[model samples]
Target: MDLNLRKAILSNVSGHNTEQLEATIVDAVQNGEEKMLPGLGVLFEMIWKEASEDEKQEMLETLEQSLQHNQVQ
Candidate 1:
């Protein structure tokens, strides 16, 4: 069985509005289920593809700061 997870995820969210998408992301993150990781990754991939260079750099910096600040000492 060949399952295209990315395509599936995109299809699931195809017609979602901003609020719907935000709810989906919040639900996924708050649920903290391992199964939700792939969906989050798919969402991030779409964002990365559409992001401008400046937006991408901001995202990178924010992520870096988050990881650094939350690091386990």
Candidate 2:
């Protein structure tokens, strides 16, 4: 994503409370726009950076399962 786009997402996200942010992310993912995936990557990176070892392992397992499910479809 371009810097401007990243900034825009951050700005929009900053304006929202936690629930709204979650809803926005869910809506974005369901929309399935190609650009959204990179944004999701950025979100994942942020979360991973702060996550504990167990949380990271769980997330990786979940991601692997999601990828496998997508591949089967």
TM-score of each: 0.96, 0.75
lDDT per residue, candidate 2, 3-70, as tens digits? 67656666666667889879878987899898787667666777899999999999989989999889
Per-model lDDT: 0.99, 0.79
Per-residue error at 20 for model 1, in Å? 0.4
TM-score of 1: 0.96
lDDT (tens digit, per residue) of candidate 1 on 1-73: 9999999999999999999999999999999999999999999999999999999999999999999999998
The lDDT leader among the candidates is 1
What shift in Å separates residue 45 of candidate 1 from its native position after superposition?
0.4
